[model samples]
Structure formats: C-alpha cells, structure tokens
Target chain A: MKISAKEVQNVAELARLELDEALTAKLADQIGSILNYVDTLKKVDTTGVPPTNHALSLSNAFREDVVVPSPGTDKALANAPLKENGCFVVPKIVG
Target chain B: MTLYNLSIHDAAERLRKKEISSRELTLSVLERIAKTDTKVKAYITLNEDQALAQADQADQAISKGIARPLTGIPLSIKDLICTQGLLTTCASKILENFVPTYDATVIEKLKAQGAVILGKVNMDEFAMGSTTEHSGFKITANPWNLDHTPGGSSGGSAASVAADMCLGSLGSDTGGSIRQPASHCSVVGLKPTYGRVSRYGLVAFASSLDQIGPLTKNVKDCALMMNAIAGYDPKDSTSVNECVPDFTATLTQSIKGKKIGIPREYFSTEGIDPDVKNSIDQALDTLKSLGAQCVDISLPHTPYAVAAYYVIAPSEASSNLARFDGVKYGIRDMEQTELVDMYKKSRSRGFGLEVQRRIIIGTYALSSGYYDAYYKKASQVRTLIIRDFKAAFESCDILISPVSPSPASIIGQHSEDPLKMYLSDIFTISANMAGIPGLSVPCGFNQMGLPVGLHLMGRHFDEATLLNVAHCFESATDFHTKRPSL
Candidate 1:
C-alpha cells in the first residue's frame, strides 16, 4: 500500500518530472500517505452495481470535421516563443 | 468613477443611455488594473490598448443605436481560455510566452457580443492546485486579506472581481475552479452544465468535465453573462444544442413549490465549517419561508467522488497534457536524442512542478501495465459517482451543499501535499463529473471573517430553476451585498 522511494522515482519517470533525490524522498512519503487515504475504496463491496461514466447519461457526442481557414498566420506566430519558416521552432531532436 | 465596480449590465445600460461611454468604462478598468493589479497580482497580462480600442468601437456601434446583451462590458478572462493575439499561459511556464491564434468558442461569443477583453487573469499552474499559490507567476492573494490565498484555479479572476479590478470575468471549472474562488471572494460564480458552454478553446484538464463559466458580483450579472455565452458550438461536439434560454427571464420565477434537496451526505461529515453549515441552514429556512420545500437526500457514493475524480481527471489530463511537449508551440528543449527524449526534455523545461506532478500521476494511472487496475477501475467508479448524483436529483429539483469544506486557507498552508490539496475540491468535483450547472454564492462568514459559500446545483441544463432558487434566497438575505474591507 505504501509508495516507496523507489516507486516514487518510478512514478516520476513515468510522469516525466525530473525530481531531485531530496524532493523524491519527500514525495515518496506524501504519495504513500495519499495512496493510503485513497485505499478506503477497497473496503466497499461494488458487487453487481455497474460503474458510471458520463454523469448526464450522454453518449456518442462527436463533432463533424469541417475545415475553416484559421486566422492570419502572422497573428498565429505573433507570440511564439521561437518561430521560423511559419512553424514553431524547437531545439533539434537529434544532436 | 471606478470602472471595475460597474456591473456589466449597468455598463451596458449606461452605454445605451449614453450616460458613460464604453471608452470611459474601459479606461476605468484598464486604469484600475494599472493601479491595483501590482498588489492583487490578479492579471497575468493586460491588453490596455486593444481593450480601449474595442471599447471605442463599441461606443461607435452604440451611437448608431446598435445593441447587444453584453456590448461594451469590459471583461477579463481566466488564463486557461485561449485568446488569439494574447499570451494565454495558464499561469505555467510551459506556455509562458505562447500566444494562441484561435479563439475559444466563448471568446468568439464574447467578441460577437462586443464585450471588451481587458486581459487574462492568473491561475494555479495548469489548474492543479486549490490555492493560486501554485501559479508560476505570483500568488493571488485574497482581496480581503492579502496574506491569505485566494481559491483556485480561477483565483485571479475571482480576486480581480473582488478587488474591483474587473466587473465580470470568465473562468473554467473542471472541479470547483470557478465556484471555490467565487465563494472565497464573496462573488457569484456560475458553472453552467458541461456542454452548456463550449470547451473548444479551453486547455483541456479533465476533458469530459471542464466547462467555461462566468464570475460576477451578483446573480443577475451571472444570468446576463450566461445569456451571452451559453449555447451550442459545432467545434465542441459536446456542446449542447439545447435552446439557450433567456437566462434573465427565469430570475423572477417563484421558488414556491420547488423541492430543494439537501444531501445529508454533504453535511454528515466534519468537513464543513460550522458557520457555513449555519448559513446553509439559514438559507434553507429562508427557502422554506418563501414556499420552497426542503428534503434530505443521500449520495452514498459521495466519499468515492474525490478518489474517482483524481483518478479519471488525471487519466484524461495525462493524455491532454501530452501536447505540451517541445515539439509543439511551447518552450522546446535544447538538447534531445530520441522521441522520448524530445518529450521528456520539452516537458521538463516547459512545465512547472505541480503540472509535472499531475502529468506523472496521470501517466502512471493510465500506463499499460496499470490501466486495468487503476484507470479502468477509476472509470468504473466514475460511473457510480455519476449515478449517485442522478439518483439524488430524482428526489429534488435542486441540491444544496457547501462550496468547500472550509473557507479559504492561508497561503502556503497545504501547498506541499498534493493529496491534501486535492481533497479541497471534495464538495465541488461531483458536479463537474455529472456535467451539470453548479452555482456558488456567499452564504455567510466563518469565524475568521472569510466568506462561506453555499453551492446550489440544478438538474441538467436547469439553470433557470437554480437561479430562481438562488434569487429567492438572495432576496431573503443581504449576504450578496457583503464585501471584504480591503
């Protein structure tokens, strides 16, 4: 039931958060306590009761694909952190 | 005259009457932001020139006798809603300097209505934290007590309104983001039914549950904002096609014979403050006097809502937040060797600690090895939680509960513990999961002088009933008029 330091590191890796060793230790304790609190659900007996999903009893709500010319490209790139050649510029993927 | 305190309705009326020009009102709000925002830290960015220009245009349109419901009302927006040509960071570093090109559906609607855009308000980074303390920019302090935190993730919007920095503002509510802060600041916030307002432009947190809503000083103002913003949008498939009722029409409906349900589950535990409990009781009694009947109902799965919400919300968030990697519009990583490295480095450098924490929790919950037991199980529980609300609604026309377990906590109080922070949303999350309208208004004050919020929830798209019940209650008391002495 306890999320240990190792498990915390693993979760961090899965989450893509770069936690320092000290922060990892702190988070392990916190996550462990939280998971323990969440464990209260284990005591319930769901039996034949079906689990719910959409609260409004809705289903199959999807919009049709219709392309509309977006606003000006200049307006789009006006606030980019870095832009080049009308596309977002990022650091090279392969070094 | 302070432009910030002018109600949207009043501002619109004044523009129509040529009493005060939109240019004057816009300048007033812009000047107020310049004066008070440094202390309130309510806005992440201010669009003074653009807002003033829009106000001028609005004035010109009105001079020609052109009219719209929200025309000329200068309003601010929460950072999460996308605004074209404006920096729309959700108070997170990931999109810190990113400007969106496309308008969210609400933004388009507001523009069509001629509502002036003042700026974007601060929020908890990626809408993760209960207090605006998690905002990467600066902590949004309560207008009443600057040392304390304002509730989040619409903390800045709520703070801006409370401090008279804006007359009306828009906020996104995934789980109490709109209502909690509205309650803390003693303002009126309306979270319309999930699909009642479009989610096309909101940065998805819990995609199935998130909706944009209005935060205003009073109920009538809320109705006017709702009238302008509510309705179907083809872009958001989930946007309801139901007729956008003239919400203002229902304000005068008699609450007589309405069956108000108070879920015993909400008050059974020690989670609510005593003053809030008393205020709710007082409101209930006032409803009784007004000819409404009070009944007790049970949402037995109430306890499981937070557990299921944290699971499903994070599961959806994990997928939604994946778009923020360096390959997209945000800050990109400098060095990367592989696709995974691209994601890792981009995300690491872009997002803040809290957003990263959630993405991690969500990723773990939905990971292949754990999906069956964690994400799937949580989805199953989400169904049951929805069923709980459905079963409760069948017994009452509207449900009443506390907005938060307690009033606003001091800044930095629970910032360190994510679980404890998540628990703060316990009372408000279910409404989002159910995709229904929930309104939070000031009921009374706790011992510490912080406002206590009473949540009123209606059946799906039944904002009329909710407003009527709330309107009736507001008339019976002066709670809505009470303000914090800054």
Candidate 2:
C-alpha cells in the first residue's frame, strides 16, 4: 500500500503524464495514504460476493445496424485542436 | 417578493396567466446575477443576450397558447452538461473553449419545453473534488456565508438557487456533488436513480456513479425538473427502458405509517459534527410527529463506501478521461513532434493536479500486478455496499440521514488535505454506489447559520417516495424558506 515515488512515476508514465520530482513525491505521499485507507477493503469478507462492475444490472445493449446520419465531418471536427483535410491531425506515429 | 425568488411552480403559473412575462422574469434573474454573482462567483458564464432572446421566444409561444410547464423558467446548467454553441468547460482549462456541437439530452428536453438557460455554472474540474476551490476558475462561495465554501462540485448550481440568481439549476452528482452543495446552500437537490436521466451528453467522470439531477428552491421544483429531464435515450446505452413517471403526482400523498430508516452506521460514523447530528435528529423527530414510523437500520458496509468509491470511480475515470488526449478535442501541445511526447506533454499540461493524481492512482490500481488487490477488491466491496442498501430498504420505505457529516466548511478548510475533503462525502456516496435515488433538502441550520441537509434515499427507480417524503418534511418546516441575506 505504500506507493513509492518511483512507482508513482512509473504509473504516471503509463497514464501518459509527465510528473516532476516534486509532484511525484507529493503524489506518492497522497496516493500512498489514499491506498492505505482503501486497503481497509481487505478486512471485509467478500466471500461469495461477485464484483459489481456497474450500479445497475445491465447487459450488452444491442441495436439494429441501421445507419443514421452522423454529425457530419465539419461539426465533428470543430473542437479538434489540429485537423487535416477532414480528419484529426496528431503527431505522426509511423516513420 | 422579487421575481427572481419565485419558485418554478409559481413562476410557471404566473407566466401562463400572462400576469408576468418571461422577459421580465429572465431580466430580473439576470439583474440579480449581475448584482450578486461578483460576490458569490456562482456563474462561470452568463448568457444574457441569448437568455433574453429565449425569453422573447417563450413569450411568443405563450401568446400562441403553446407554452409548456417550464416555458419561461430560467435554469442554470452545471458546466459539465454539454450545451451546444456554449462553452461546457468542466471548470477545467482543458475545455475552457470546447463548446459542444450538440446539447445534452437534458438540455434538449429543457429547450423543447422552452426553458430559458441563464448560463453555465462552475463545478470542480471534471467534477472530481468536493469544493469548487478545485475549479480552474474562481471558488464559488456559499450564499449563506461568503467566507465559507459551498459544498461542491455542484457548488455554483446550489449557490445560484440560494442567491435567487436562477429559479432552478441542473447539476451532475457523481459522489455527493449535488446533494452536499444543496445542503450547504439550503436548497433541494435530487440525484435520481442512475440511468433514470440519460447521461448521453454529460461529461464523463465516473460512469457508473455519475447521475444528473436538479437543484431547486423546493421539492416541487425538483419534481418538475425531473419530469423535464428523466427518460430513456438510445444515445446512452445505460439509459434504462423503464417508464418515466409523473414525479410530481405523489407529492401530496400521505407519509402516515411510512417507514423511515435511520442507519445506525451513518450516525455512528466518526467525525460527524455535533450540530449536524442535532439537526438531523430534530428532523427525524418532526417526521415522527407527522405520523411516520422511524426505524433503526444497520448498513454495516457503509464505512467501506468511500474507500471503494475512490478506487472504482477513479479507475473508470482513468479510462473515460483517456479520450481527452488533445487530439480529437480540447487543448493539444503543438510543440511536440513525437506522438508519445505529445500525449505526455498535452495530458500533463491539460489536466489539473487532482485529475493527474487520480489518473495515476487509477492507472496503478488497474495495472497488471495491482488489479486484483485494488480494483477487484474494491469492486467486491462495492457489491457489499449495494447489498447493504438493499437490505436496509427491505425494512424501510425511505432512509434518512445527514447529507454531509458536517455543515459547510470554511473556505481553505480542506484545500490542502485531499483525504479530509474525500471524507466529507462519506454520508452521500453510498446512495450512488447503490444506484438509488437520493435527495437533499434543507433541514435546519447549525449554530453558525450554515444549513444542514436531511438526506432521503429510496429504492432504485423509486424517486416518488423520496420526493414525497421530502415534500412532506419541507411542508412541516420553514428551513427551505430561509434565504441567504446576500
């Protein structure tokens, strides 16, 4: 339950965040305390209890494959920070 | 009485009778906001021109005899709910200018009924924190005492109604966001059963727990808002296919012989302020005097709720917020040429400290080795919490408790202490974890005059009982009538 700064940095990296040393230390302490508190869940006997993924009991909701009108390319792309002809422009991935 | 202070029911009746014009009502509210919002900082954005234009259209509709129940009612929408052509910042800088192309389903329904949208109100950044202190903008002050914090992340919505800046407001409750603030501001806030109101356009925080509901001047207005916004929508897969009831129909029903459960665990929880306990006990006594049966109940798993919720909510939040990678929408770091670097730079800069911390915690919890220990264990505890509510409801028609362990804390009280702030939600989070309808109505004020809220929670999809019980108590007391002398 004791989250170290190294582990916090690793998790931050996995979460696609860049944390400085100060923030990493703070997060380690805070997250460590939070996790320590959450560790109380271990004391409860959840024997034979199924994990609840959702508040309500719901199943896979299916619909007909009928095509509906989209928001159209322009409106959909309105909030995009950068855009190409019609698609979102992001930093290139492939060489 | 000032036009701004008129309840939605009274305002609608007057509007229909042609006694008061929608423009007059809207202008009065706008003027009130202009006069008081500087001190309260309740609104993030005020739509003055558009609100006046809508009021004119509503007047035209009334003249044509096409006015609906909420025809000219001015509503302050929480910033988390998307409104087309309006900035829907989740009080975060990342979405400061990210106007949605479409309105949230609730907004669509309100617009169809000719509801006048006054503006978007402030909330915690991405609805994460309890106080509006976490907002990228200004901290929203509790209308009762400007120096005190309005319990949030729906602080602005609650403050607006308390200050008479708007008749009613819509707010999203993930974990006590609506109810806690409503309690602090001495307003009525209802968090309907999950999926009762469509979450199609609500900004995702914790999907399983987040529910949008109303913050209003009274119980009747809360019910009226429910009628406007509650229904199924195909756009949100989780939206239930159940029939939306006339939420106001049962308000007049008697609560005689109704079983009101007082959870022993809730009262026994550590750190419950003495004034809050006294106020809640007095409210229970009032219910008993109204010929209601008060029963003692135990939800043993109540203590584990906050811990479980933090894990489950943040874990889901990590996945939900992963969509905000600065590519499709929101801000992007243009300087980075590499995709990975761009993602890191954009997310690190785009998200606030609390958000980043949550992402890291969630990521760590859901990571390979820790999943079973943290995420899975917490989820199992969530099941136990839900079962506790199920058992408690079997013996009671409705459960009553304090909305928060304490009344509104002073500003900066929990600003530096994350764990302390998280504990403020202990009394309100279980209802969400159980997916039941929860309402917070102003019960009484503490010695300092900070309002205390009486929490009423009922079985899933049974908001009628909760509203009816709250309405009955509200009728018996004048707590809801007391206004901040702002």
Candidate 3:
C-alpha cells in the first residue's frame, strides 16, 4: 500500500498531470496513508459478491433516435480557450 | 421580523396575499447579503441586476394570478450546478470564468416555478472536501460562529440559508456535502435518492453517488423545493422513471406506528462527540414520546463504508474529470506547444492539491495491475454495504443517527490532514452509497453553541417518508426556529 514518489509520478503521468518533486512526495505520503486505511476493505469477506457499479439497479436507458436541437457551435465554443472556424483549437498533434 | 428572515413558505404566502412584492423581498435579501456576506462569505457570485429583473417578472406573474409555490422566492445555487450565462465555478480556478450555455435540469425546474435566482454560492472545488477551506475562492464561515467552517462542500448553500441571505438553496451531494453543512449551519438539507433528480448539466464529480437536493430554513420548505425539482428527465439517462410524490402531503400524518431503526454500528462507532450523541438521544426520546418505536438494528458493514467510498468515488471521479482536458471548455495552457503537454500542464495547474491527490489515487487504483485489488474490491464492499441497508430497512421504517460525528469544528481543525477531513463524513456517506433519501434536520446545539443535525434516511425513492419524519421532528422541537445572531 506504500506509494513511492516514483509511482506517484507514474500515476500522475497516466492521469495527464505534471507534479513537481515536492508535491509528488507529499501526495505519495498522503495517498499511502489513505490506501493503508482503505486496505481495511480487504478484510471484508466479499467472496462470491458481485461488484456494484451503480447504486440503483438500472439497465441501459434507450431513447428514440429523434434529432434534437443542439447547443450549436457558437454556444458550444463560447467557453473554449482557443477556437477557430467554429471549432476548438488545441495544440498541434500531428508531427 | 425583517423580510429576509422569512422562510420560503412564509414568503410565498405573503407574495400570494400581495402583502409583499418580489422586488421588495429580493431587495431586502440583497441588502441582507450586502450587510452580512462579508462576514459569512457564503456567495461566490451575487446576481443582483438579473435577480431584480427576475423578481419584477415574478411580480408581473403574481399580478396575473399565475404565481407558483416558488414564485418570486430567491434562492442560492451551489456553484457546481450550471446556471445559463452565469458563472459556475465549482469553486475551482479551472472554471473561474466559465459560464454555462444551458441550465441544469434543476435550474430549469426552479425557473419554471418562477423561482428567482439570487446567485451562485461557494463550494469546495468540484465538491471535493468536507470543509469549505478547500474552495479555490474563499472559505465559507458558519453563521453561528464566523471563525468556524460551515461543514462543506455545500457550505455556502447551508450558510446562505442560515444567515438569511437567501430563503433556500440548491446543492449537490456526492458524499456528505449537503447534509454535513446543513447540520453545521442548523438548516434543513436533503440528498434525494440517486436518479430522483436529473443530473443533466451538474458538473460531474462521482457520477454514481452525486445527487442534487435542497437546503432550506425548515422541513416544509425542503418539501416545497422537492416538489419543484424532483421528477424524471430524458436529459439524464439515469433519472428514474418512477412517480414523484407530493412530499408535503404526509407531513401532518402520524408516526404513531413508525419504526425508527437505531443502527447499532453508527452509535457504537467511536469519534461521535458527546454533545451530538446527547442531542440524538434526546431527539430519539422525543420521537418515542410521539409514539414511534426505536429499534436497535445492525449494519455490520458500516465501518467499511468510508473506505469503500473513497476508492469508488475517486475512481469514478478520475474518469469523469478526464473530460476537463482543456479542449472543450475550462482553462487551457496555451503556452504548451505539444497537445499532450498542454493536457498535463493545464490539468496540473488548474486543479488544486486535493483534486490532484484524488486523481492520482484514482488513476493508481484503476491502473492495470491495481484495478482488481482497489476499485474492484471496493465495489464489492459497496455491494455488502447496500445489502446491509436492505436488511436493516426490512424491519424499520427509517434510520436515524447524527448527521456528522461532531458539530462544526474550527476552520483549520482538519485542514492539515485529508484523512481526518474524510472521516467527518462517516455518518452521512452510507446513504449516498445506498442511493437512499437522506434528510438533515436541526435537532439541537452543542455546548459550544454550534448546531447538531438529526439524520434520517429512508429506502430508495422514499423521500416522502423522510420528509414526513423530519417534519414531525421539526414540529416537536424549536431547533429549526432558532437563528444565529449574525
């Protein structure tokens, strides 16, 4: 359950976050303690128990394939940090 | 009494009788906010001009005899719930200036009933923390004592109602967000059964656990708000297709034969403050005097709730928050040349420390090798927790306990330790895990003069019974009538 700073950095990379050494170390300690506490769940006899992904017993909700009014490009891009030609502009992905 | 001091029901009656105008009520509330908000720090954005305009429209509607229960009544919204063209920050810098293009379903419902929007209120960033201290903006102070926190992440919603800045407020609860703050502020708050209220436009935190409900001055107002917002909506796929009851109808009904379950695990658990325990015992005695039977029951998996919730909520949160990659909306790091670098820098800089910690924990738990040990194990434990509640409810009408382990603590009491802050939600988290309706009603105050809340939880989609029981308790106690001298 002990999460080292290296593992913290690796997880941060996976989560698309960049953490400095100090924050990574701090998080390593904090997450380690939290994981240690939650390790108590290991003691519970959940043998043959199904995992509950949702609290309510719900199935996939289906709706008629009817077209509805969208928020439209103008409204959708209103909060975007950068945009051009009615679309969001992000950093270059192509090499 | 000052106009701002009127409860929602009282204000609605006065508006109906033409004894007061919406403009007058709204102005009075605005004046109260101007006077008290500096001390309480409840509001994140006060919608003054728009609120006045909405009030005038409500007045016109009233003149035409088209006034509804919430007509002309002003209310605050937790910042996470989208308000069209209004700032919804989630108290995070990432969304500091982001305004919604459409209303959340609850906001649409509130607007449909002629409810006036006072403003957006502060909450922990993305509704993450137990204390409003985690807000990217300002810490919301408990109205009872300015130096103390209004237990959060619905701190602003509860504090605003307590301080008379607004008659009622809307708040979303993922864990104990709404009820814990309501308990601290001595107001009424409810977290309706999951899927009872539509989650469309509510900023996702932990999708399965998050639910929107009301924070009000009294039980009846809570019911009134429920009537306004509770129903199925096609916009949210998880919204239940069940009937929404008139929650106020059963308020006057007797609880003479009601069986109130006293969960032995919650009572026997350590860390419950002496004063809170005393208040709950007295509240139970009062219920008993009113002819309800209190039965001792066991939810053996209660101890595992917080642990299981931590894993499941954050795992889901890590996935849900992955949408905030600085592409569609929210802040973006324009300086980063590479797309992946922008995603990393934007997220790390935009999210706060606590948010980052949760994301990392979630990512680690859901990682390839650790998924079975953490997320899967926690989900299985959650199943056990839900089954435990099912067994307990079979022999009891509802469950009662302290909403929080203790009354409102001083502002920095749990700031240093994240685990300590998470433990504050022990009593309230199980209801969210079980997807049951939970109500927090003012029961008594501790020796420190801070308030304690009596928690009542009912079966899935049974908010009516919870409200009725809370109303019955409210009638027999004067706790709801007491106000802070702010």
lDDT of 1 by residue, A3-74 (tens): 677876777677666677886787667656655665666655666656555555556776558777776677
lDDT of each: 0.82, 0.93, 0.94
Writing each residue's lDDT as its tens digit, candidate 3 over B156-272 gives 999999999999999989999999999999999999999999999999999999999999999999999999999999999999999988888998789898999999999998999
For model 1, the interface Cα RMSD in angstroms equals 3.0
lDDT of 3 at B375: 95
Docking category of candidate 2: high
- What pairs collide in candidate 2? none
Q: Residue A57 error for model 2, in Å?
A: 0.9
Q: Native-vs-model 1 lDDT?
A: 0.82
For every model shown, what is its TM-score relative to the native structure? 0.95, 0.99, 0.99
Candidate 1 residue lDDT tens string, B145-258: 888888998999999988888889999898999999999988999999978998899998888888899999888889999998899887887787898888889887888888
Model 2, span B86-170: residue lDDT tens:
9899998878779899999999999999999999999889999887888988899999999998989999999999999999999
Instruction: Arrange candidates by DockQ, descending.
Output: 3, 2, 1
lDDT of 2 by residue, A21-82 (tens): 99999999999999989988888998888999888999998999999999999999999999
Q: Judged by lDDT relative to the true structure, which candidate is superior, 1 or 2?
A: 2
